[model samples]
Target: MSFTDSTEAPIYAGLVEEQGDVPAEVRRVAEEVLREADRAIDFGTVGAASAR
Candidate 1:
């Protein structure tokens, strides 16, 4: 998903490289954040992203 967002590539890459091995709970929230990012960006919504 983020592979298409060049603007987010660096950050995504760093996240993968750094916290890719996080615990299950942390990974779950991270997944939620990524999904939310996609939801916000895909919809071009403003407030939704920060609502988390």
Candidate 2:
């Protein structure tokens, strides 16, 4: 599920339309989410390598 597909996307879109940008906290949280996703992928790769 993506942010756009999520129920929150509509609310976020409305805020962007009205405010001209996402809130700073929202942007920061998004960055953190992406970083955590990256780390999860990296960890999976490392685990696979170790298993092999």
The numbered model that scores best in lDDT is 2
Candidate 1 residue lDDT tens string, 29-48: 99999999897776655578
The runs of at least 3 residues in candidate 2 whose Cα sits more than 4 Å from the true structure, single-residue gaps closed, are 1-22, 42-52
Among all windows of ten consecutive residues in candidate 2, which has the lowest summed lDDT? 1-10
Q: How close is every model to the real structure, measured as TM-score?
A: 0.37, 0.37
Compose the digit string of candidate 2's lDDT tens values, residues 1-52.
Answer: 6444337699766666677665666889999999999977776678788888
lDDT score of residue 52 within candidate 1: 78
